[model samples]
Target: MSSGGSTALKLNNILIFGLKLLVSAGSLYIVFSKNDMHQVGVTLTRIGPAAFLTASAMYIVSLLGATFRWKLLLPERFTLRRLFSLYMIGSFFSSFLPGVIGGDAVKAYYLNKDAKKLSLTLASIFMDRYLGYVALIGLGMLAFPFSLGLISGSPYKWAMPAIFGSFVIGSFLFFGLRLGKRFRVVSEFYEYFALLKDRKDVIVKAVLISVFIQIMSFGAVSLLAFAMGEHIPVKMVFLFLPIVSTITTLPISISGIGVRESVFVLLFGLIGVTSEAATALSLAWFFSSFVGSLPGLAFYIRHANKPEVKNS
Candidate 1:
């Protein structure tokens, strides 16, 4: 495209983006008006500083694990500084956009250009996520059996199918490396799995770290609930939060706001928790996550003087 055409497109995008921002601001206002902010504030008052501190610690732990994980995925020749910066930016970006695009794209772009093994880096990042989700399922299973008394009576009784399916999928990924002839379905799967088999020493370590990240995050949420003085057991989050997190990870609702709020209320409602309380907790979790990314805005500000690889 010509320079003039590129400039025109850029201007058009800016206008569209500004319009979307206005729409989002308006929507948030509407949602806020309809919401019971008084109850939300009351609930917030119930939560103590210790809980906030724990959540902050949890954020640090998660961010550290992600940075370390990305380091492992970096090409042998890649710079650690670049990988770490990307990880920080990625964590910050994930807080904004729905799903994982913001951070995932940031990491993919940087790793592709710098790592020199773009495909492997991509596969590693994805597999890292796959393991993280599977670990969450594992964590949830550990939590659910004891909380069966809380969950068995709810609509979440459908969890059997979900758990069974996650197991089957995880098993397939673990053992599917041996398949050769049926490579067309997903060649990357074969290669990545094969790499894992060949590098069990490294792969196992990465998976463990991913699991730890999930545990810390789950603990963080439960800590907030506890600090809020809710009668709900910590064991309850272990049981249902993984499922909720997994649901929110789905691409349906924006940033998983509606889906997460609905799940928090629905799942915890089994224990007689109020929908308002659920909404408050969910918002708190999101607020912490968004606040945690303030450092990313710092990074962007520092780098503003340099030419940006604008996402467009």
Candidate 2:
């Protein structure tokens, strides 16, 4: 019976994978069907030696941010070089997974081997993920109006309010739970607040790292725009890219191939750039990932001999 159940589960996953592939392919077809491949080539051709350097800079900056953020999460004994290696491999590892794994499992595994505390490891991992969301929220809401002026048609018109509401509701829950714990009104909520109280700086560092990560991604798009000869404001591009990035990270498409291009096309076109240009820009953005992954590949090659992390 167990064998039968396992087989059935495998079949279900296979079916789901098939459907996701179809949807991703169909979306890619739709996006490409509307534009000229020749023009995309032209756009790529226009990117010269300087663009490569710009892309390298963007990738390096993002890599540094990830390294720094991960380092902050570790206990003091861990060296920067060790954290850097793990950070690079873990990030590259996420790209290989079906969804954005984002290094939590791999990272936690190594940290646990050293610290051996389930709570500390888990707390830091959750805190790391939480900080990123908080930062993303800060970037969107705090600078919404100024950023909106960058593009002509914001495809994500609901983006600011949606993220804003999430932050507000989240903040309320956080404060409400803590209040309940401190006053002994609802001692049941104490565990959650206790976690926070024990680790005061995790949340702050996470928020800061999240902001840094968002900025790196936002900066990439602006550089792409610059490479493509677009003169849009950095603030506007920063806002729209994050919203678009959230859409791309949805895991429905392969590396967000079609969806991101579609969003860029619609949003940029509304701002008077031709669909061809928008398509070109989006394609450039997609290929840039391959460039960014080069260092990650090198890091993995050097570190594969390490033992697998025991799960907490």
Per-candidate TM-score against the hidden true structure = 0.78, 0.79
- Top candidate, metric TM-score: 2
The residue pairs in collision within model 1 are none
Tens digits of lDDT, candidate 2, 1-312: 699999999898777667766767787788789888787778767767677567656766776776677567655456667667666666666556534344667766666676676556665666556667667767877667775555436556667668668667877786654554554434433454465657768657756777888887777767777877776566666566666677776767665667888878876665677777778777776566556655776877776666644332
Please count the clashing residue pairs in each candidate, in the order shown: 0, 1
Error of 1 at 199 (Å): 1.6
Clashes of 1: 0
Which ranges in model 1 have alpha carbons more than 4 Å from their true place? Answer: 1-35, 48-50, 75-81, 97-101, 164-167, 170-189, 301-312
lDDT against the true structure, per candidate, is: 0.69, 0.67
Candidate maximizing lDDT? 1
Off by over 4 Å in 2: 96-105, 108-123, 147-156, 170-202, 306-312
Global fold similarity of model 1 (TM-score): 0.78
Report clash pairs, candidate 2.
131-206
